[model samples]
Target: MQETKPQAVSRATDEELLALGRDVLTIEAEAVVALAGRLDGSFVAATRMILGATGRVIVTGVGKSGHIGRKLAATFASTGTPAYFVHAAEAAHGDLGMITAADVVIALSNSGTTAEVLTIAPLIKRHGARLIAITGNPSSALAKLADVHLDATIEREACPLNLAPTASTTAALALGDALAVALLDARGFGPDDFARSHPGGALGRRLLTRVSDVMRTGERIPRVAESASFAEALLEVTRGGMGMTAIVTPDNHAIGIFTDGDLRRLLGAQTDFRGLAVAEVMHRNPRSIAPDALAAEAAATMERARINQILVVDESGLLVGALNTHDLMDAKVI
Candidate 1:
């Protein structure tokens, strides 16, 4: 057969394109907003069912609903609820075995008549698993069979032809997110728990990293005895390159801190350079944090005190390490 060339259509003006984009967003936004009003006891019941389940949440759908299901499953799993997506069509072809009596199945279908999802809905229930259906039609067979039906009905699709799934899918996704957030709150999921699931992310670095992990220790720390001359402390500061030096006692307990800022202020006030004790100009009772404290806490302390450097001290107040804003930045803890 000979192939025929396609005819070209007229291009849309920029104004027309912008208007269409705005319309789509408005429609989808309205659909999601409408869902908030429809939510009743059924929403709470679904959350309680999932919370009480001993097994995982099995999210299943097809087409655009499947895409939403995959995202919802990931959101659920990351936010303390154990969940995973299973394609409805695949569920019929041996994947149904993945569901169990203890599991709670969440099925997504805008029309609530998707054959692929309906085919395995009975088997899912027969396995003793409870079904939570999200659909546009409450009277559809799938919704009728569900233990709890979440109405996702929308006035119209965002698509110009009103055929493609758009507003409906967005509403379904927003509903799923609401469910997941409810479960997270119920389980008291916190930032620390979230950090554990996302250790490679910035929040993980801030929450999991400790002061000792990024502090300058040993010879890297700039230190001077209380009896040291101002010149000697300046030498240690320049050599350590931390822009500051810790003033310590004979037992190495931090007593004060001297920084480049203090040096500038002193130079402005007095020009005597022959003999000056670091103890005379050093800031006494410097802010310090424990080595085991979180690096984020260190950052907070520095920001609150408006200081660039802080000393890390042990239980006995002995200087163990030192860190500045630069070190926190290097570790990406801030």
Candidate 2:
């Protein structure tokens, strides 16, 4: 008999590889859309249960589900819900004591039969804490034991081998987001509330920070009497370190403001700084903000007016403080 060579399988072309990528995305997207349709009264009940709980939400899971649980817990905490993550394996070893009757436990398990989670399920029930399950299999033991089961099932895995968790994990994460947003809406959690939870971030600065927090007060405020010479105003501006000085009335109300830019304009007119009064070259009705206004609002006002500095005034129109763009930047409110 004559020897024969075996035929080799052809490799995928660039077009074929691109098509495969699109197919994976399409599968995952469809899986998420399907979860939306699967949502029912159970989801509403779960949201209510979370809202009604007097204590924090305890999230637990294993493997990839555990990773998702951490993010879910963080999202919950950041969005007005008191929540924290507990590793399922650790729960089996004595972490179950963390669960109290005041808490509601959310367990993530794609198979709904994860051994580590199953080990602690009954203990949670005994503690009088309600159990909410997010799982791909509604008929799984975890779902059957849950007070409310959220269906995160998908028709197929995005992985070609049908072994890895791709579409299922995406569905579970989307479902978690849906639940958190629903709770957020029900509780009327606004930007101000969100800012309180994020004091060190930009969003916090924009919403929680006030002009009074970043403005220069006391002797740091650059100011001069309206009758003072421009040379005196220049000295005040230099001492204040701000680019401008406020020309104030005898009662300390700001009548006008003089800036370095004003000096350039004055030089254009061949005027001597010592010969002019502070009021002569000052800008009347200069842009001013209230000390209580949000720092973000101040930044916006400066941007719209195309100015670098703004005066902070009290309700009496007195110059109580002053700030420049640099101050706002340093405060991280710009």
Candidate 3:
């Protein structure tokens, strides 16, 4: 074996380096734009095929195409389509068992003639699984073998030598996104559906978290009767630590709310509080929300009403729970 010596590279000026970066972006952007214009009925057909598939979508490829395929599979799955990526070489080594007759296989190859992918194409077809090929060459074997072919050909690579997969990979990924989005629309996938798939994400918290999930229930909610003394209401607010206390009737119906802010304003006004009643100081018509409403809707209401806390009431207008800005923050719903 011969040892290879490294060569000294010439350093380019800052402006020259930036120019190269800009050129790469421009080339890749142009490739994507051109791909959008070249979209025809084949794109529509691919979407319809995936939408109609009774089983999962199996995305497979090799090399750079494999990376794109993996991302495409994740996108499809996250957007309501059941899909996953299987490396082409692995499929040849028995991973092909994952594919079923009802599955749809999406194969990606820039040249449309990857030997590893070609090796398994027949086996996939033998299983009676449908194939959708994304390749640069429409006449290539993979394209011809496919039930539907998506042309992802780019004018040229963004690589300086035009040998690396740059613009071509971008085009394929964009085409996959287009197909996934179209299928999402066809399935009528809404934010709630998306949130279900991403339960740990922020969107999920905003969409799926109801006020009842974060509101303080039972003894955690600070409550004082409307006939209670002002000092008793202040004591409940302090003990509750929610900065506010709900003033309820004898039957637990919320009548008004009083907060520390109200106390501060009262103190500033130099009002005598020796024998004041909670009903005398509490703000009537305090903002309230149903326990079943979204936490996001509760946050919106709080913001619009310029209040830090809201009382949760049932259909009968009985106090059920209470939450503040801190609770929303704790739930990560804000």
By lDDT, the best candidate is 1
Clashing pairs in 1: none
Q: Against the unseen true structure, what C-alpha lDDT does each candidate score?
A: 0.96, 0.93, 0.95
**Residue range 35-142, candidate 3, lDDT tens digits:** 988999998888888888899999999999999999999999999999999999999999999999999999999999999999999999999999999999999999
Ranking by TM-score: 1, 3, 2
What TM-score would every model get versus the actual structure?
Answer: 0.91, 0.82, 0.87
User: TM-score of predicted model 3?
Assistant: 0.87
Candidate ordering by lDDT (highest first):
1, 3, 2
RMSD of 2: 5.8
